[model samples]
Target: MAEAAELSDQPLFSCRNCQNPLALRSNLLSKNFWGKTGPAYLFSHAMNIIVGQKEDRQLITGLYTIADIYCCNCGEVLGWKYLRSYDVRHKNREGKFIIERAKISKEY
Candidate 1:
C-alpha cells in the first residue's frame, strides 16, 4: 500500500544536525528510556553511529557499562549504547541503543 511504501522509504530517526539516517522505525523497541539530555528511545539496531569507549556508570536502573554514541556524520553526541549490564534484570539492554530524543529528529 502507499503507506507501507512510504514507511519503507524513510528512516525513523536521523541526526538533528546533519540529517544522517540513524535508525529504522522497525528497529524501535521502547520509548520509556532516559538519556543525559532528557527522554530517549531504545532501538534494537542503529546505523550511521559511532560507539565510544566503554565505561561503567551508575544509572537509575543499576550499574551498566555503556559507550557514548555519536553521529558519524556530524560527531554529535546522540546517546549511549549498553555494552554490559551488571544486573540480570537489565540484561536485555546490554546490546540496545539509547538515542536521546533531543539529539535526533523523527523523519516521518
Candidate 2:
C-alpha cells in the first residue's frame, strides 16, 4: 500500500479514543534512518510523547533498552521508547519512539 499523504504543513497524528495529536509526519523516523518494527509501519520514531516508569518493559536491542510509550489522553499502547541505559558502541538511537503508525491517523 502507498504511504499516507500529508494533509498539512505538519500532519498531526492523533489517538483513536480522544483524537489527540501525538506525533507528526515530519517526525517519521523511517525516511531518515532505520527504526524499530511497529505493528504495521516500520522505522517509526517516538520523538514527542509521554513516557512513564510504571509498567514500562525493558526490551533489549543490542545494548540499548526500550520502554513502552502510552497515549497521554487515553493511556493506550502507542509504541516503544528507547532508554539509553546500556553502553552501546554508537549512541545514534539512544532515545526514540517506534510508534505504531497503523494506530495513529494522519489528521489534516
Candidate 3:
C-alpha cells in the first residue's frame, strides 16, 4: 500500500466543483480476498465514488454523499457513489450506512 506522504508532494486530483482533494477509502468487502490463485493482486477502485463532473462542474444539491477516491489538486474527479437521502434501505438486504462526506486535502 502506498503511503500518504508518498503522494503529498505529488499533484492532487480534485473535484471540478468544490476543488477538494479526492481521498482513497477502500471498502471492507474489496479489502478482503482480493488476490487468489489466478490473478496476482487486483486492487479494484470500483468501491470509490466520484464528486464533480470534469473541471468546471459543481456538487449538485440533490446529489450528496459521494464516495470519493482520487486527488484534490489538478481537479481530478475520482470514484464516487452519489446518494439521494440519508436513509438507504433495501428489503431483505443489509443496509449501508454512509457516515458522512469529507473533503480530502491530500493524497494517500
- lDDT of candidates 1 onward, in order: 0.91, 0.58, 0.32
Against the hidden reference, what TM-scores do the models get? 0.90, 0.61, 0.22
Q: Among these predicted structures, which one has the highest lDDT?
A: 1
How good is model 2 by TM-score? Answer: 0.61
Query: Which residue pairs does candidate 1 place in steric collision?
Result: none
Better lDDT candidate (1, 3): 1
Best by TM-score: 1
In candidate 1 the C-alpha lDDT for residue 70 amounts to 94
**Candidate 2 per-residue lDDT over residues 30-86, each given as its tens digit:** 633233454533234543357866343435445556666777777877766666645
Per-model tally of clashing residue pairs? 0, 1, 15
lDDT of 3 by residue, 1-108 (tens): 365565465554334445453333442223222111221111222223434442211232222343433444443433343333333442211222221223222234
lDDT by residue for model 1 (1-108), tens: 885576568668889899988899999999999998799999999999999999999998999999999999999999999999999999999899999999888887
Model 2 lDDT, full chain set? 0.58
